[model samples]
Structure formats: C-alpha cells, structure tokens
Target chain A: MYDEPYRWIEAVANRRQYLDDQFIHGSPLVGISCAQGVLLLTFNRGTEKIYEIYDRIALGGMGHPADLEKLRFTLLDMAHVEGFQRSPSDVTASRLLKNGLAPVIKPAFEEIMRAPYIVKILLVELGTSQDRDHLFTMDYDGMFAEQREFGVLSASSSSGDRLSAEWKSFGVVASLSSALEIGLRLWGVASLLQDSSTSPEVKIEEKDKPSSTSPSETPEEAEVTTRIREMLANETLECVLLDRESGKMETYRSLGQSDLQPLIPTEFQPAT
Target chain B: MGQQGDFLQVLGEQGYDVERVFSSHKVDALHASGMVTTGTTVLAMKYRDGVLVAGDRRATAGNVVMYDRTDKVLELDRYSILAIAGVPATAFEMARILEHSFKYYRRSQLQDLSFEGKLRALSTLLKNNAPAALSGTGTVVPIFAGYDLHDTCGKIFFYDILGAEFEAVEYAVSGSGSSTIRGIMFYLNRWSQRTMVELDEEEALTLVLRLMTSAAEFDSATGGIDTQAQLYPIVKGISAEGVRSIPVERLSQLFSEKVVNHV
Candidate 1:
C-alpha cells in the first residue's frame, strides 16, 4: 500500500544504528583535481574498498556497505528521468543537482540523519559547456559542501591540509600525474600518522604530532618513510578522466608499482 | 504506528486471521489455470560497441492468435534494454516496474546501474513472482542486455521461470524458438568467422532479423516481419551512446533485401 519509497523507510529506520556502526569502520579516500575543460579523479586500489561508480557521477564513499553502488545508479536514473519525459537538453548538472538529486536524497536523509556515512562526489559533465566541474561532499544529514580547484575528504585532516597545499602549487591545468603526485604523498602521510598514533609505545598528545623541534628522521618517522617507499614502489593505479574533445569519460589503469616513482618527489621517498 | 494499530482490528473485521496474509501458506497448484496469452521469441546479443536486442510482434493464446503488433522489447533504462517472453500482461507490468525502479535508483544515487546489477535486480523481481510462477499465471522471463560503462562493452543476461539468472557469453534467446535461434546464431558466427564483438551494429541487426525469421519458421507463435500486415519485429540496440529502437523503415528494408530475398 505504501509506494513512495516508504517500503525501505521503516527498515532503514530500524537499522539506523547498525549502518552508523559500519560507517565508522573503514576510511576510504579519493583525490580530485579539475581544471578549465578537464576533470580527473584518482582512486586508491590499495584499500580494496567498494566505491560507487555511476554514470556522470563517480563518488568515493566512506561508510557502511563499503560501496553504495546502488545509490549511485539510482541517482543517475533520477537525473535521466528528469532530463527525459521533458527533453534531452534538460539533462544538465545544475538541473540534476537541484531538481533531481536534492529532492531524492532528502527522504533517506530524514530517515537516519545520525548515520555516519559520508559521500564525496565528483560531478563530471559530458556536454560541452563553459561552466566548471562540481565537487560535492555530503554527510548523512544531506548537508552539501561545494569545492573548487581540489578537495579531499578523509579521516585525517593533516592529509587534507597537505593535499590542499599541493593543489595550490600544481595550479589549474596540471596534468593528471601531477595531481596524483599530491594524492600519493598525502596518502603515505595519513597512513603513517594513523599507525604511529595507534602504537602503544607512542604516548604523545595529538597536538605534538610530527613535533616541529623533533628533527627529520626519527625512528617512528623512518618506519613510515620505509612503508611509503614500498607502497609506491609496487602500486598499481586506476585513474578516470573526462575527455574534452569527445566529451566522453574514460577509465584507464596504469600498471607497475614503480610507474608512479617518477612522479613522487625525492623528499617523500626513502633514501636508497 | 500509522497502520499497525488498525492491522488486527481490520483483519478481525474482514474475517481473516493474521497468519493468513503474513505467514507462509501451504498451497498446491491452485491459482490461475495455464497461461493466457503469451509472447514468444525474444533474442539479445552483445556486439562490438553495445548490445542488440529484438523481439517478435505476436501474442498467442495456445492455438489461437490473440494480438499482433505487441511490442515484446522494452527499454529498461537509458543504458539498458529488455526483451520479454512470458505472460504478456505480467511481462508488460514487469517492464514498467523495472523502468521505474532503475530510474528511481539512478536518481537516488546519481548514477547508472552496473550491467550485472541490472541483471540481478531483474532476477530478484522474477524470484518475487514465485507464487505466480508456481500457480502458472504470472510467470515472466526476459533476456536483458545493455552497455556497461565500467566494462565499456555490451553484456547480456537471461532468466528462467523461477527467476534464476544466467549470463550469456555471446548470445541468448527465450520463449518457443530459443534452440532454433541459438543454432542459427552459432552457425553464422562460425561460418562468417566473426566473433560476437567483431560484428558491427548493422551486421548484428541483420543477423537478428535472419535468426528471428528462421525461428518463426518453427514456432508458429513467433512473428516474423509480415509484409502483408506491414508489421516488423521490434528491434533495438545499445551502444556507449544509449538505448535506441531501430526505425521501422530500415527494418523493413533489411527484411526485404537481406532476409526475404536471400532466404
């Protein structure tokens, strides 16, 4: 008798706590850099987490059900339905976000706003337009934050800060590898910080991390430095980008762990 | 709380026990007797760029012909195509639900369903109709094919009456003439020395017409392109571009020049 997505509403409400608990378990990450006619997203295959890859909208999810793959598809279908029934020209990013996306995600949001799932979407446009690409980071409550240039949503803030700085230095129209350079370094830093913080031997307070006066190669830092080199030396990267001339999105995989070695700066790698 | 308080009271008034509707029932072959009108001969295959799906135009009730111009093929979503071959009414309803669900899902998630995901959803719907299938009334099975953005190629899946799914490597067919159609495709693929992926969209369309015609020869229920009725089989293709039905004029030409004159 109930048809307005009420079928799942009751169940979603009952399992609200379970979903929230799962969201706190794993930390998935994505690095995005967009320029005047080009947008690029880099995913970390090293984590083996599920990611929601949909048409026109590829998002990185950090929460329960690792890959919110169905949600991504439903979102695309909603956009298509809005664009269709009316006219094909009606299919635009701005229109989809306003009329298609916002209204659709509202019901699920209201059901369990306290859930810990966080969604970061890189909205790529296939049509030729002068408008810029959009990066939207949404929390469980449907709060939307728009980012320009670059954005990183992860468990660690230090990594975000470092990535932001890299974005600034790379400038607009930076190649995909340049953006990946920033992501790889930040990924190493974040993982090491997490490992060190969780170690029983390290009892330092959060404020004194990477202590300014602690000098460069401490034993803990040395261990982190070694792990980064190993990961970089054997990492296989998966990258997707939106084509400018054809306006088509293409996904490609670059093999070899050392493939990215050239892009990683000397300072980030361990001394040979 | 909204409808919970009224459930027991309502059931009491209606003279029905709570277990009647909610709990499992032990019933045997007691619903509708046999299927009414049924559709036949739905075929789908993966080509180089995208998927090619086609279906016949006839609806049959045992020995009697119920309707012509019945479209058996349906577009499930922007990126997928469905060809139904079961109870005509249930098939139509299933198509409608599928179209709605895929659209609802994409909008809610802001993405297109994966090729495998679409197949799984269709299979779930079929499984849900188990009661109807058992009683022999609402049974529906269809061949699903579509372009997967992830794989960047065409993919096809078929389902049984029980709603179990089977993935087809090269081609798939359902209804009264599946074996006949399957053999024709196999022969052509072997003789022509072209892998399914090597065939262009146009060549794929022609092959589908030829196969449907051969299938119509054996299965009276299967409809071929009828020149007198000016009716053609429903044909559609899916590519990286999207799902689109092949125009009637082109189909008529192909039937006349390729299938009719040659065969």
Candidate 2:
C-alpha cells in the first residue's frame, strides 16, 4: 500500500533523530486539563516520548528528544527539591514548567547565543482539584501559555496545524480513553489516511500528496505515519494520572496494546 | 581620580595604601567593627549512617560571654552542614553567603552542589577573605561535615583562615577549645575503635554535647548549655536521608542526662 521504504521504530527506544525537510517530524503532544487532574498524551515518534510524573506533577515534552530528556530530569530534580523544602503544595505545575525553563535554555543562548532547539513542554498539577490544576505549553524560547481545555503541539507542521484544529472537537468532558485516542490518531500513521468520511473516492495514492490547504505534510509521510502507528501499537501508552481516590500521582501504569487497541483506526494500515 | 581610570590605574592615581587594600593581606575598614573574634568549640564525627556536626551556642567578646543563643551550625544542603568558630559577623556572613550561593546553584543547576564542590566554594570564599584572616581581626575557621553518597559514608572537611581545605577521616574539631575537645575525641575514638560501625545517632549526639560541655567547663569564652535561655549546642546530621537537626526536645534531654546530671 506504500511506495516508499518505511523506517521502522522500536517499541523501546531511548533517542530520536529528525530529517530536515517536510516531515511529519516527531509525534505531537496532546494535553487535556481535567476536573481532577490533567492528561498529557503524545505518540511515540522515533525517540521515546518522555512522560515523567511524581506526587503532583506530570510532564511530557518534544523537540530534540535528547535535550528534552535533559530538561525532563532537571525539572523533576527541581520540583522534588522544592517539594522537600516547602510543602508539596508549593510545586505548582505552571511554575515548574515555566519558571524552570530559563536556566536550562539561557546557557545555550550564551554570548553568541541562540536557542539550541525547539522543546515544547506540557505540565499538569495533580495535587489540586482538577479545576485548579494548570496546563501549560512552554517553548524553547522559554515562553509559555496556559491552556484551559485542550492543546496539541506538532513538530512536523510549522504552525502545528492539525493539532490546533483538532482541539475544538476534543470535548471538555472527554474520557481518558478518548484523549489518548485523539492523540494516537493525530500522530498516528493514519494522519495521512484520508478521513474515511471525506473523499472515500480519493485513493491512498492521493493521500500521499497532501492537499496544498494542509501545511506541508511530510512528502514521504505515509510510510512515516505507518511506522509511527505500528511502533506505538506494540508498546504501552505511557500516562500519569492523579488518582482522585488516592490523591497521589499514579506513576505505575501498564497500558498494553490491548488497552489502547480501540484507538487504532480500521482504515489505518502499516506501510510494510 | 580620572573618570576613565581602570582599577589599578585609579589606585595609582590615589596613594599606595589604596593598592594595599586591593592586593595586600591587610585588614582595614573593609571589615566590620567586630569581625575577627573567636572562642567556641565545634566538632564533628562520622557515625554508622551519617556525620554529626555541632557548635556551642556561646558568642564571646574576648573573655566576656556576650551572647548565649548564637547558632554557629548552619545547614548548607540536605546532605551537608557547616559549623563555624570565628569572628561572629564573619562566620555568620560566610554561612549566609554560602547558603545564598547554594540556593542559586540548586535553582539553576537543579541539583545540590557536590560535597567536594561545596568545600572548594567555601575555600574560594575564605580565600577572598584572606586579608581578614591574616589580620586576625576578621578570621573564620570552619568545620564542614556531610554524607558522601559516592563513598557511602559520612565525611568531614576543615578550613583555615587562609581557606586551606583538608578532609578528615573519623572526626575533626575547631575553635579556641579545639585543643581540649580534640583530646577528648582522640580518647573516645580509641575506645570506640572496638566497634566503630556500631556508633549510632545517639552516641554521636552525646559525644558532641560532651565536647561542648567540657570545653565550656574550663574556657570562660565558650559558654555551657543554658537551659535558662533554652540554648544548647546546635547538632545536625547529614546522611543519604539529607541534613536534619536533632530536635530541641531531644537536645534538652541529652543535655540534662549527659552533661547536667554528670556534672
């Protein structure tokens, strides 16, 4: 069904590298701020999508996956120390995600300084009531914006077109399964799959050549998308939830392929 | 003074005493009114799980006991504690500067400074104050102790007025009463050699308390524990669990049972 050679992704990968041209770069991160906690879900592109959470915070980030990994550990260390000195309540989601970004980013922006890479960080607070929880998107430039309901940040498209468009349809009362479903779909191999409802007449070949209306979807997009879905399907979907009952960050999760299989669309076919 | 003069250029424009303040080891108006005074005992020892650091609460002006509630022991991080025995202002300022610097490091690096790194930094601070140390008017000699995660044991570091750093195995003590307390610790170290690993928190705390009490017994400058003022030597432990102080209630108990009752 696919003309180009598909790059296979490993179920357990530590790093990811991206191609320069029009690519459905890495997977986009989708976050939904809930009434009790916030859910941040992203597809595993080539590198391992870093999902880190402790007591009252969960963070997921994209960009130079290596730099993202560094940023992740730094944030966790800062939050842990802050939680230790002050009450755990002092570690707010936005403060950790926003205020904490500068020190890591500024050093790279030294004398002849330029931001090293683009990194989008999503954070959610689990200790507060879901409404009080904060959802934030921070860029490498160290600018962050709070999102009330839902937000999706894509790396492939310059403006993250697909992600921004999909949030309107992502309901506020959407269940956890649907949040992950929408995320897997947007970053899924089927991203190039023509919406089954629209143009059932358009062949899979036309889907390869994305319409001009959509920002440059990766030209070799189908194979990329297919590999992303297959790689994601075999691995467990990582998640961090604040168990409303326990009032604690839920770190241990076993989200097997069986659990998320429903999110995989039938029309989606791996480009083997 | 030339408006465009560089620092050295400006010093030349002024007199030579200006240069003396800049490069020479001479304490002058740069120091506070009461900077180089000393007279207290602070000692630390390695135990089973961590190192115990402590300092007597007395502040002295020569032979006069000026204050009885000073806290000479400062916690640098979760894993390190510093006890100072020097000029009151200089000691407190050094501790304050260190604390602020560590907070900056923690906030920026997103991690605590390493034990060795902390020692180097303190050395740098003391090195900056070499003139005061040489003048003997604003000197600071400190004993730093902390848990070394890499070595899996408690360790101690000592500093001189010139900011020379030395790592001590087993135990270290500093201050006017150091000569007396060192003798006590050396004797205790020989007795405890039979089962060094068996030394626990209680034993470490009691040892530090005994050192401080005995130091004050003969030294008029180092005051003993004052229950009337609710002042006792400040004792802290640094381990994998991080730096924490022994509770005052427990300190009071140790003071009454070990020092007060024995006396």
Candidate 3:
C-alpha cells in the first residue's frame, strides 16, 4: 500500500524553506524577477515537475489564504492533470501569466499593490530573524531587488524608501562592534516609528540605591555590573547583537537580562 | 776512519753534549750542545660539557723570541683535538703525523679512533723520536681533548717528553708557562660548575684570554697578544655541533674591551 499521508508530510517538510531535521530532502530554485515584480517558483522532480508562480506582493507578510490555495491548486494541476512539463522557456513572467493560473492569482496581486506593509513585515520576519542569509523583496508591479546587506519590504513605498536610504547612508561596518551599534539604532528608530512594544530604554540607578553587602562577593564583580550598565545606556539600537567569539546571536533586549559579558572582548575594560 | 766509520761517530763527534741540571729534587742530565729553545706550553681541561684545550703562543730560541704567532692548538678529528708545546717545528710535525695517522685509521676501519687511541698514537710517534730528544735535537709535548660520544662527556689527555700519557680529571696543562696559566684557571674552575651548559662560547673565550694574558706576563716564552696584527689568542669551541674557531675580529674586540678597562 502507498503511504500517501507520510509522503505528503515529508513533502511539506521538504518544500518549506526551513527544516529542523537533517534527514529530509529539498529541491533548489533560482527565483528571479524581470517584469511582473519578483515571483518565487518551485521545481521539484519527485512531486510537481512544473514552474508554480508565487506573487511577491501578495505573500509579503502573513500570506493571503486564497492566494496560497490558488498557487497550490495550480501546482497540483500542472503535476497531475495537465502533466505540463517546465522547459527553460516556461520560467519567464510572460509564460507564467499566459498560463491558466494567472486569473486566479490576480486578486492577491492587486491587494499587495495597494498595501506594501505586508512585504516589509515578511522580510523583517524572514530576513533579519533567521540565522541564514536569504532574503527576497519584490515590488508592487513585480520588480525584484536582491539585498546583499539589508532588505526592506513594505506596503508604504515611502517607508521602504526611507529605511533603504538610512541604511545606505550608514555604509558597511568594518567591525562587529560598529555593526551592532548601527543595527540597534536603526531597529530602535523603526520600532519607535511603528509604535512597536520593542522600544529600548536606558535605566539609571540613583546614588541612594541599596547595595548588597555579601561577604562572598568580590569588588571586581561589582565593577563588572557597573560596566554592563554603561554599555546598555550607550547602546542606541534595538537589534540583536551577534557574539563573533561564541557564534551566538540574541535579541537586543535589556529586560531579557541575559549575560552580555561573553560578547565583550577581554581586552576591553569598560570605562565608567 | 772511512766514510762508513764517519756515520758511526761518537756523541762528541756529532756535537752532542749532556749537561746536568737540577730537577725538582736532584740533578738530572739533559742535552745542552744544540740550540737552546724553551718548550711550548699546551693544556687541556675537562669541563662539564666539553674540554678546553689551550696553548701559549711563544716560541723562543734561548732568550730571543723565534716565533710570536704560533698556533699550537689543532683539531685532530670530529671528537678530538691536539694542543702542542716544546720545540715549535718538532711539535707541529708530531701533530701533523698523528693527525694523518688518525685519518688513515678512521678511513680503513670505518670508525673514529677513541680519545685513548689518539693518545696512544701520539705517544707512539713521540717514542720514535726518543733518540733525537735524548741527543738534544728536539722534543714535543701535546695535550689531547675530545668529546667521548660513548661516555656522553669531554675527556682530556696530557703527555710528557718521554711520551708518557695521563688522563686528567678536570684540568691539565703542559708547556713552559702552564703553571701560571693553570693557577689562574684553577680559581675559574672553582666558580664554574663542570657543566657544559654553564660555560657558553663567550664565557669560555673570556676565560681563555684572561688566562693567556696572565701567563704572557709571567713566562718569557709566553708572548703577549699581537695588537698591531689584530691577532688574539686562537680559541676554538668543540661541542656536539662540532668544532668551530672563533672569528679573529670578535676575539680582537673582546681583547680590546678587556684592555681598555684595565686603567
């Protein structure tokens, strides 16, 4: 008996961009945009052997259910019923739109053209949030921009423009310390403008604050705490800082109260 | 007498006369007819790492300094060296003959002659010339130093005019000025821990020059360092790395520095 359910689970796990398990297999695709914004098309030999079109704008943030469903049907239809094989010629934007699937995919496309916020949110979620280096930002009408440094996707064209301009002005950082500072400041500004709950704040302790008199504690420990406070106050961003030495990245949240000493080099004796 | 009878002449006919001089205890007979020359001073001292072999560079014919630039020290082979004294030419010839003999033996046997073997060879060569020495023709005394790879340390061999060989424990000296040189070196020996690591190339050279200077001052046969020629005492260091003669320029610099500070 054919194990349809198990095969379907494996396909879903493999087809998705990310996989936690090492045993799963996945196919590679080169998603490019020429005329009709940027579109992602999957080519899998085991499953559907056809170019399935995905609207960049429509699937920006949280993808539209109707758009995803129509894409799924198109893929299945090409694989099973029509048995439409994808040659090199079938990969173009004109060929995809000329196919029968375009009519069903048009509504979600219009929605993305009206709202660019979905794209920005999707990019911020997938691009900056992931440990890997893969981010795609497609335009409203369908133009693609591959970002080498940082990518911004948004419904509001002006907001995306502002973020890109600001990021470009900062330029490439030579050291990790400088990158962290710049990234945090940009994220902080973005959070403030978006009115998000992730805004960072500096905490100042008064001179009269009660000090613990533990006999076991050394003076060096107290000095370290003070130095950490100074670094937190000086930090201008709300972005994650990656520890190059330990190869670990964490959210740049002061309230999380994680140890940051590992990120600081031993050569640095933080000044009061 | 016929021509053959001329060859069989008496000691007086050959201008050979035996004279008596006081030894340490009593009178001893020594030849006095021929040219009187002070015997050379040669010494070999066993140190922790290796042996130090030195010689005074003074060749005298009676009261006149015949040769002031004599190099009495010689490297016999990889492991051993010879330092000569007595008649300069005779001593040098003996050194050369022994060096050749050692080379010949090493080539034939495909192995190096040991320190003791080298001493025996030198004594054999000297024994062949005993008749000439008794007739006041010439005499040579040499000190041999070598690093015994089997023993893992340095060894020194001292010889007398009669070709009698003796192995010294720590230090040995031969030559007319050896007593004075030995006296200075004895004090230095006490300070040095018989370890080869204790004395480096610089310290060894310094010690040798100091001893040489003291010997030159007291002994008429021991000549002073040639400052005009920029020639200092010839110093060679032998270690596991092999024998290397110190550069004359470096020795001259060291000698000048020592001389300038002497007020």
Q: Which candidate ranks first by DockQ, i.e. highest?
A: 1
**What lDDT score is found at residue B88 in candidate 2?**
74
lDDT of 2 by residue, A144-251 (tens): 778666655554334454445655555454566565555555444234422321234544544766664543333244554555556555644554444444422333
Q: What is the TM-score of chain B alone in each candidate?
A: 0.83, 0.82, 0.78
| Reference-based TM-score of each model | 0.47, 0.57, 0.41
Model 1 off-target regions past 4 Å?
Answer: A1-272, B1-35
lDDT of model number 2: 0.62
- Please give the lDDT score at residue B28 for candidate 3: 21
Q: For model 1, what is the error of residue B48's alpha carbon versus the real structure, in angstroms, after optimal superposition?
A: 3.2
lDDT string, candidate 1, A1-272, tens digits: 22457755775665544544443324435545434233333334455232323334444555444324444544445444443334444555555555545555555556544333344333434334324555565545455566665554444333445445545654554555655655554445555544443445554643457555432312344554566567655654444444434333322122234655575568556567
Q: Which prediction has the highest lDDT against the true structure?
A: 2
Model 2: CA > 4 A from native: A1-24, A27-60, A65-117, A122-135, A139-144, A148-272, B1-39, B60-69, B88-115, B191-198, B220-223
Model 2 error, position A116 (Å): 9.6
* Candidate 3 regions with alpha-carbon error over 4 angstroms: A1-272, B1-37, B47-49, B191-197, B259-263
Angstrom error of the Cα, residue A247, model 1: value is: 21
**C-alpha DockQ of every model:** 0.07, 0.02, 0.00
Candidate number with the higher TM-score (1 or 2): 2
| Model 2 residue B98 CA deviation in Å | 5.0
**Candidate 3, B112-195: lDDT as tens digits:** 666667767777767666655555556667787777777777777787777788888877787888888777667666665653
Q: Could you arrange the candidates by TM-score from highest to lowest?
A: 2, 1, 3
